[model samples]
Target: MNLPNQLTEREPIDPKLAVGSSLPNPKGLLAIVLALYLVNEEKDHLDYSDKSGNTIILKPSLITSLKAFFNGITGYNATEIDSLASANPLVEMQIEPLQVPLQLFWKIAKINILGTDSSSGERTGGVRFPKELFFTTNMDILKNVISNENGDITNTGKELIYSWLTNNNTPTSSVNIEQKLTKTLSVFSEETLFKTWNNSTEIIFQQEGIYNAFDTTNATVDIGGTKEIKGTLRNLKSSISKDIHPYLKISSSNVELKNPSLATQFDNYQKRVSNYLDLNPKSIEIKIVETEEEINVDDVTILNKIYYGAPGTGKSHKVNELLKGKEERTERVTFHPEYDYASFIGGFKPITEVDAESGKEEIKYKFVPQTFTNIYVDAWNNKDNEYYLVIEEINRGNCAEIFGDIFQLLDRNSDYSITPSNELKQYLVKELTSVDGIKGIENGKMKLPSNLNILATMNTSDQSLFPMDSAFKRRWDWEYIPINYEKSEENPSSHYQVVVSDSISFSWLEFIEKVNTIIKENPNLGMDKCIGNYFIKAKDNSITLEEFINKAIFYLWNDVFKDEDDHIFEENTFYEDFFPIATKGKEKVLKILEKIGLNTPEKED
Candidate 1:
């Protein structure tokens, strides 16, 4: 039996029949494979029945092919097969043939495993490639069968089970594993997932099957959602032992820890599994659940709010935090000087389209919907769900020019609906009216859907770029993100520290606070151009002196006090310490701030 090259000579096998060693059911197949070897050794027969009462029979012709294939791949003679199986045994290989999709057969030149769905060729559940065929098969042929596909998972339940076997590439800790399991279980009902994992693990023939700790009765502690996986891991660790260490050993089947040698075997298995998981991190399967949160559109008060603040005040971060889990419904766009009506709203744009018959690319103009219009249609389609269109640096673009006719949409009536103009109506009718769930259009006028929410962020410094009129400003509820030094320092997550030469390293939080204090005190340089804590972040809780001079000092010298009184720059208390570094070009500038000192906190002795 000669093997064909799977890569170049691509071939398709009968999908209905279990071809190749793609063992979809690893636990069951492992039992069947082990049983085949054991039965052949003890009784010299190829007959067995699994827990499902499926009879497995191995044919001599298939066995001969497997023998040759094994010798060809492993370079072992037929006589050495048993010894090969005993030493360095294939206990659990991740890329099981049965678990892989049928379409993946094209990936490997259609190498087929001969086995019963239960055994060999008995046809209990249908014709399946036997376990002996899998044991003798090339391991490389079975690798990455589930992964390397750019499509949706056809069998999500099987993929989750596979994740349990492989542990999602990070086996040392159950963090990534549990995350995958939690994400996978999110798709099914809490009850269904719990039941599936519970029932999937059953010792077949009482002697043949392999089961995992994740499939155990104790592992089914949580099927709630992604949030509950951490608790589930804790339950598993605590429930297993009174005193669980960082690395607790979960034993393999029939492995007793009565002696040190037996305990060592369990540890080895754990290490091997962990290493395999680290290598194949992508193997963990998860499904992002739609409609994770339930939000009522009517209850929303601030329908149009602009988060206004100084640069690096975390206005965008605040918006993300507000819509943390509901990211599917939100779309973001950064506005700039070039942003205009055509880019902000739907317009006819030249796009290249390939002519299918001619096989040529042709330039044509089509009505392309922009961020706002696209979100509008999507919100209308999903009326029950609230949608957000986040505009970053809203002040950078000319609001009047960019908004154009759609600016009227901002004017909401008592019920929070806007009447569109005749021109806007023609465009909406042509582009959106026919779309699913797009209602409320009447007499060439339209209303903003109740579910659609517009969120924008603006930097106070960039407010001069496109000064919004009073009417436009009136429409939006302004939320100010103030620069609070105390609040910045209080955040335990930000471990940002600055270590300056010739001075004690101070908290980045403290440095920004001191700078902002001086800026506030100066009449000419007020709050408008004050430095925020987020302006200069420390890399690994450490900032270089050069970086401090470049970012923190440069900003104050350039932008903050550019047009302000030179006396403000000459403040001895504020500008002294930075002058020695600021000397090369500006003699007058350095003379002014030569004695400017920053009240950085002294390091504790």
Candidate 2:
């Protein structure tokens, strides 16, 4: 066969070839091993039935030894011939075709001494053994060596079997032979021997006939193809062993051993099988190709945006929705009054460490990275994936002091860069050196990658706490989340009702509309002082009398209408009078609602 130059050209063979009726029954490592042994013993001329119409029979002694062998390996007794025969072929046609791949594995492991070529016009012929065979003559010794008292092969027995199989031509340890055979057999069972196809019998026979052709000199000419095959087989074995390890019925009674060499072999073999059983190679490869395609697509637009609104207007919720599935790519930090450059960027912080020479615990100042530096390095390292840095309550912190020299990075379009301190320069060199598309770090200057997005949320009510200057404010695109009064599924607060009493309740949105109108009409308090739709979320869609007075009524009396000559509350009514303990406190709130045209005796539906 003239193989293609690229390994990708050799698409995986039809999956049916690995699972169809042509393959052996009870497919497993044990079944394949036993089948190979039987094929070798029978010299490819084994009969499945006698003239009396009974199946091929075994001697009682041989049957008992086989049962012991099966029990030793699987911890399960063979109560009938069918259990043993399931692994063995039942017809001459089935028996003859298995030798091609079986002998190929043996040949790969340099143990092809028991069989001779039997060419019957097939691409790969069946094995025909010599009249007297060393393996057949010493069958009892082999069985005893494999199934000793401890149900494990001793080193001495392994050496004996190795020497017998290879005739000392390969100068290697017995462990090497064990690994070679185990790996080759695993690949044979998963990749070649068990494959099936829904083709004509002639086509299936032709495909099976060529199993050994890959071992020929012509196939070896495409060295790249050979290496690719070997790599895929290794990955296949690893994937299968991992999938099957959890379900393997390993026990002290079975042939699986605790010895390091055998245990390692078993551990390696245990990692594969489950995925191979249900594998659709084409679909799996397509997913991988799709991932690569996604990486090459256009990068997401970089954002330096701020979401600002009155308290409880879902400013934070807006940012969360935009970053729903990109959690791994996002980092969030809430800015407070105490936040500064050291906390926002990288700095030398005291960390506990063990002294290498003294073997004692001590404190050391290391360049510890905060959210900004951490996400900055990650964004440059993984340029294909979008990264985010979210700052909550941005106006709560003094941005000028918190950003320091790094504030220049907010102007992403500029080619400007910042020179780090000596400690930070060394850290940046270690992290950003040799990273593609990142420049000037080695020269002690650094700039942000285009894939990094900086998002912040601000409460308009707190704008006076630490007002951001014009330079800092101009760099970010600002968005305002207005109060949503529409009583729809999207507006959770629209369904809320302030429970004034058992017989009197009013829509929370209606109360806000009335109170906001009064606040807007007052010259001292306008839109900024208007109550937000979500100023207080209701529990079970009901805001209790206590919560309503403590939160809503208190804020309106103290903050919004405290200095206004015209207000919504009754004359001489103070904030304390709205408390539950005040005389007729609930009645006073009901009267205020009636004054605002919201005291209709109706409950939420």
Candidate 3:
């Protein structure tokens, strides 16, 4: 703190002074020279130093803890230097084109593409393929193709592409994804990969030399001895997905206007047209039925490729049955009001990271395969099987938002290729995708099992309603399944079935007829809301006869007489369905029934 008047300063190493070096004289001058020397020290010396030996005089501002960085005690923001590094996008993968021996080979192994030996296996039809074709014993060569008589492997690529087929997540990412053989035995890799067969057995990719096979360009490149390539047209799974987009599904609309007297008086032409639904004034088809005269369903997968309808009517249940063991796959997803894209795809979720000390807030990336996503993935590369995705209550939420980039994927009629959603692109490179090089979904086509059929179910009665856009409307086959009232030898008794506590109960066919009459007389009341589920809850939970009436009355209060009731009759009338408890659990329903009245009959003896 002393001024130039009288003060002493210590110098760590005194530099040789010029004959007239006046800085060596006064203490203030000595401080100046020492400060300059310390500040100009080499960078390595700055890393560690003995500051206690000498005080390097610096500006008082530099001594302030926050500003000490300027003094170089803590190194300068040297990390900024990284900004000068060069960025090169070209990626390279190295393959040492080695010639390996045909150490092992097999023939005509009877196998099924479905990967099963069960009764279902018989359905795919047994195909003979080369089997146990191993590069070595530990390495099991996956048999995926057949060989023809003319010294050529079938397009199936079964002769050579060993573990890569059956073992997924291999060739992990596309980058320079080349395989190397450390212990090159009889040239098992090189011979099949480079020579002998020429283009006859393996596809000679146009890509010359080593390059990132994961790149979009190489996605179509067929590898040596591999029966299948990612992007090629011959790929069955991708093709099937391309074909089924435009099929219309119609099963849930009642075209009849229910005017019996008017029907009786109408001309034959009028009755025929009304039955066709196009002539019905209030008819709305949930799934399109290919009537005698109407637009055929679009044949594109991205065209309204999905259809969701009522529960017990067996919308999903029916679609699954249609495909049943007939198709290769049947995938299902239940869409609630809360279903989200994150649950469908991949996302960052909260997690705990523990170390030697304790846990800390961390993010764990989770790849959540949505019901549709998994189906699409499994179906994408396989050509031999049909895949189905059943979205229960497909429209309960905003499909446009929830589907993100894949909304286009559901377009059954649009062009199938497209850019992936922004979210999927942000987290990964194209190498991560299952199909060829599908960086995104575009043109309404999901890069999936070309055979994928989407069947979505939307209970027309759900409260979380949405008005489907006109464009989306035309893309589907909206079928309405109205109740079949007459039950005889041909129509046979259509009983009302219910599931209660694991046990099932059925009422007479007449019960459905009575309810059908009520719904017919009152168009505002939907059969899905008033009939099926009503009986389900009643018969399943064992509600008494009075309890059934009380529950049915509450059900009517929902949309049946929702807005019509007055406030004075609110408690007793049970309109608006209580707003909250229309979709309540058993507990809330018990409470509502207790307060108002009972569905149970009086127990007077």
* Tens digits of per-residue lDDT for model 2, 533-599: 7788789999988888888888888887888778878989987776553336787787788778875
lDDT by residue (1-605, candidate 3, tens digit) is 87576566642111111000111111121112212222333111111111212111222331232122222422233232121111000000000000001111111011121233211221111222111111222222211112245633333222112112112222333111112211111112211111111232423221111112323333232232322222211111221222211111111210121233443333342334334433323222312332212212111122124433333343454444444343435556676667777776546565555544555555565444456555555554433344466666777776665666665555554456555545454433432354432422433233533456666666666735755676565656665644344554333324333211133232324444444455545555545554442233434334443344355545555545565433112355433443433233333334433333333222223
Q: What do the candidate models score in CA lDDT, each in turn?
A: 0.47, 0.54, 0.33
List the candidates' TM-scores in order. Answer: 0.46, 0.50, 0.40
**How far out, in Å, is residue 220 in model 1?**
45
lDDT of 2 at 193: 24
Q: Largest TM-score belongs to which candidate?
A: 2
After superposition on all CA atoms, what RMSD does each candidate show versus the true structure? 19.6, 22.4, 31.8
Q: How well does candidate 1 match the true structure in TM-score terms? A: 0.46
Model 1 per-residue lDDT tens digits across residues 1-605: 89886877533211211112323232233223433432244232333221212323334443454354343321234553332232211222211233222112211122122342321122111223233332322212222222236532223322322223222332233343334333222211111111012232311110001113333234222221222111122222222232122223333212112334544554555555456545544221121111113222211234688988887777777777556534656789999999988787777779999999999999997777788877777666544345688999999988999987667778664444456544445656765543344474544456677557888999887788889999899988898888756544355325676554444455666556656777778887677777765676667768766676678667776788766664335544344446565343233332333334445344334
Give candidate 3 regions above 4 Å deviation: 1-312, 326-328, 350-369, 426-449, 488-508, 523-530, 533-553, 562-605
Q: Which ranges in model 2 have alpha carbons more than 4 Å from their true place? A: 1-302, 437-442, 581-583, 602-605
